[model samples]
Target: MSSLVSFFAGAFIGGVVAYIFSRRVANVQFDNAKTRDKSQKKRYKDIYIRASNQRLSLGPYIVAIGGGTGLSTLLKGLKCFTRNITAIVTVTDEGGSSGRLRQEWGVLPPGDIRNCLLALAEDDSSLNRLLNFRFDRGELAGHSLGNLLLLAATEIAGDFRKGIEELNYMLAIRGQVLPVTTESVCLVGRTKNGSRVEGELNITTCGPDLEELWLEPRNAKPLPEVLKAISNADLIVLGPGSLFTSVIPNLLVEEVSNAILNSSAPVVYVCNLMTQPLETEGFSVWDHAKWIAKVLRRFPDFVVANSTPLPQDIASRYIAAGSMPLLVTPEEREKFKKIGVYLIEDKLYKINEEGSVRHDSVKLAECLVRIARSAREREIWKESIQFSGMSG
Candidate 1:
């Protein structure tokens, strides 16, 4: 009996020692795994940073011109491709929060500017939410937080342009947003009935076919920075926004049009997905391009148009709202070919969750990047040929 008890004691001691040793080994392995995970994470972060910096330096410089959601949408997509983007926004906004701020503060409308700024924001952060916030009551009722912020920023910086610069720096924005002009001006339109309407709000709401459209201050000069951006751009894009109010207003600035004409870069126009109720009722894609060419006295080298069909339900909704899909008829297409404009049509639009038609930003950006790449290849090929000829 004494020998058996001694044997049992020995077994218990051995079991405890074995368990403790295994536990220590497991803990050491776990510690090593954690350290390796951290190291891997850091390495990935470093690589991403380096890659982003490399793309920023090597990407082609692109200038996108328009206003409202269209320009912002383009910017959102293009930022994924290149950090070197310049958004030239129109300044003729005279409705909603922008109009109210303009009347009360005597400043250029901030509504469009705010949208561009948020679109170019590096991330969807608290600042973006703060800028998009809106007031529901009191003196600030119906005012957008971004418009008020821009107004305050203008006051703090002592100049509208400087205010934008400060905001851009604070946001670490991926690209630059420039107003088409600094002068405070209203959009004017003439009805086919020989009546004149002023202010963008009145003009759009008039519900009549517009005979002509112009700015209140006909000679509103384009900003020098805008001209410089155009001159330096590898590619220039126009529109995908309201044809008369958003797109053409930028071209109304004489210097802006001239710069576009003089620039060696290829100019591309993004046609709207649908005809706007009052602004572009019964219009076709060709009508939009024709109007643009008429206003600028020149046509774009290319037009990016949507070839996607809307879902049945979404199509019904738009039709109910009196909007129609902008179709590119065969005759109009021939017109584009005759004018030396390349019409690149693709599945460029989609219905968002809100049931509104929106351009696929990523897809659009891809097309623009492809075009830029092709342009570069052409440039290189031309240079090589010239060098060979000279040497020969």
Candidate 2:
């Protein structure tokens, strides 16, 4: 009985020791597994980051010139293709919250720049909603939070360009936004009836019979950085915005236009989706391209127009508003061919939930990327030919 008791007690102690040892071993294995999982996750993360950086670095350097919703829309799409984008925005806005800020704060218009920044932002959805918030009451009535932020940034940085750069980093935007010029200037236009129109608002609203448009303070200089960007661009895109208000104003700065003319990059003109009531009332795609050529002093290498037909209901609404779709006709294609300009038409339109027609960002971007790639290939071939000639 004594031997039995001793043996049973000894067995119970040994079993406890074995159980404890097993538990320790299991815990150590679990910890090792967790460590390996964390290390593997980190390694994958590093690889993804490196690849993303390489892709962005290898993207073609594209410079987009315009302002307003059109420029922002284009930026939204372009950011997906390349991080090497420079948005050169028009600063002659003299209306809305931007106008008020310009008049009151004595700063260049921030509305367009703000829009471009948001469009290229890393996380646009949340940031856009926050910055685009408008105050409907009190002293800040009719002003956007974004404009105020830009104003504050400008004040803090002590220079408009520096302020914009600061916001570029703060927003973690995919590309940079630059004002066409930092100097304060007004958009001036002359009507076909010889009536002089001053300011972007008057020029846009006065009539579509605008015979001439120029910037006030005639010698307003283009930003040096803007000129450099144009010089280094692999592709330059103009428009898809209001012709007189958003696009032409930038070209009015002689140096900017000159830079574009001299650049080896392929230039593309993105025609607007629809005509504005008083601005482009009866304009067709050809008319739009003609105006651009008139200002640019050269026809763009390519013209991208939407080929998608609008829904009848949507068309009716636009018609009622005195705006019509800017369609590319067969005649326009022949005209473009004569000018040595390639005409690229695609199903680029999308109807939002609100029933308003806009460009399909992804589709438009993809088209532009393809054009850039083609241009790049042609450039390489040309260079190779030159090299072979030198070798021979």
Candidate 3:
């Protein structure tokens, strides 16, 4: 009897311990499930928001020409307005990871192109951060992952354009980004002192006023697609970038300049917020317009400039760096009007995330849309008058 009782007690204790263990495990699993559901709900919310934002993107077909952070900044803002955007980027870059790649693998500089791609990417925030990441150590030091990715894709696709296409599909970019040309072009500038400065990097710090800018291989044919974009665009935008290296270099291509002049689409030049050191040290709004007119032989229909003053802290920093806001005098405004270029000035600048004074993308986009809409309205009114006259 004693043996039987002892065996029964042990069995009861073992069963109770196992039951307690199972209950603890069940509780933990239930908590884990709740956490996963919460994560899924947040992700779903993000997707819903992105989808809703894109519904209002049927604004206009805009073509933006230029390069560097300024061009990309404009692109980032413009995407919110329209899905039909074509960014024509200058590829004369000779600095940073792009410079190294061009020197080693003999490819067109990828830095600016990469930036344009990220700017127009559908998943702008996350992918932009990823592509802009730079390695700090080892052989990859100072190299941008986006530049490397472009280089590899180019090699794999056997051409740069094809590689860009592949990335476009993978990233679901909002609009197209095209190089001005496929040839490895060099930016050459003639300083006012009659000294010649070659290469994009050297021209910026050449310490002289640039009087003329040109590209090597003067006969370089533009990518046919770029011409098509300009011809079909409702509006074309120029500048808000490096005056010599970015904006002028594109015009140096004879065919590209001709396309802009021939197209009925109105051309608008988005002037920079401040004069660059050594390039446009004391440039005013008129100076910027005249230089562009001199090269293209036709003035832009509209010139958009910032009318807002910079914050004192920001102004001081730029002043110390030998830069200042571009002044558009009343006389200059009248002169531009006499020459048929409408001056659209607004408070279009702000301190960007990096704490630098730059064009506010949304504000700039708003200004552009306003001009484009007004132009469209005028055209419609003219057509209506013609129709009424004929019917009468």
Candidate 4:
């Protein structure tokens, strides 16, 4: 009986010892996990702080002019380089959901502005998809949710410009977007044959070469903020978009064009990747630059052109759709140089899985930043030289 009692006591002591060891081990594991988590958090905090500092101190003031996917694409790339960006969007859209909204609500077209806002949003992955959601099989068919939200915002704010400002804040976008003009204006194109075409859609679709382009009323004033942005900009960029419809429409606003010309900032023009049917058919890089010069009344300081060739399948697809790549020849490069415009050529294109081509945004932004730095240095040197000469 005594032996049985001793065996039971030993078993009980063993169970107690095992429990205590397990509890100690669990406590050690918990402490280690806590330390690891704290270390990871510190690392994340350090990264965030560094990124914030770079954005604040390293970014330059830039004013980008144009409208359409081209401007949005550029914005997507540019926001990575600078927080001080002002996008001057053309307001003469007369087709698609923007057209419908304009006609129905009498508001400025929100499509391009929405796109720019999305491109600059802090977290655009889910929001981009959500806002770009289109409806079908209802009265809302063919209208994007973003357009509707912008329309609603305009109604709530009781002013178009105010509404846009509200959205700029609400979306927490990296930069500002301004319409070239707040007034209701129509695009009018005078064909080389002396025929007048009215509306952006018709003009883009019109077969004849455009000899002249102007805004209706001929006195559309620019937004005051646009001029201020131009005056404050360290660099100005124009066009990777349609020449007549997207880029030139802003220039047609006399005050906007004059401000751009008067600003001390150096202007750079990004040439289109492919020639659009009827709009820029058979046009070379020089041809695009010449048109911009004609409208701006002076040549841009630099022209960024893509020198990379498209894949065979993509090239064939684009050709089939009546579009061709804009090739820059050696002769054209010499012509640009003669005109005092620097030609920047590089492999600046990317082809999507669906055979669509676009400028590689990150690569393009890096190039623009490099150009801005060089231009700023040159300006400083020139100023210093002039000061020295005066002192002497």
Using lDDT as the measure, which candidate wins? Answer: 2
lDDT of each: 0.84, 0.88, 0.84, 0.86
Alpha-carbon lDDT of model 1: 0.84
Candidate 1 lDDT for residue 222: 82
Ranking under TM-score, best-scoring first? 4, 2, 1, 3
* TM-scores for every candidate against the unseen true structure: 0.87, 0.89, 0.83, 0.90
The lDDT, on a scale of 0 to 1, for candidate 2 is: 0.88
Per-structure clash totals for the candidates:
0, 0, 0, 0
Tens digits of per-residue lDDT, candidate 1, 308-388, equal 678888888898898998767788788988877887877788678777789999888888876776675666421232211
Weakest lDDT window of 10 consecutive positions for candidate 2 = 383-392
Highest TM-score against the true fold, candidate: 4
Q: What is the lDDT of residue 243 in candidate 3?
A: 76
> Per-residue lDDT of 174-230 in model 4, one digit per residue for the tens?
889998888999999888889999999988876338888899979988889999999
Model 3: per-residue Cα lDDT over 37-143, one tens digit each: 99999999999977756664656778899999899999989888777889998989999899999999998899988999999987788988888899999999999
Give the residue spans of candidate 3 off by over 4 A. 1-57, 206-208, 376-392
Judged by whole-model lDDT over C-alpha atoms, candidate 4 comes out at: 0.86
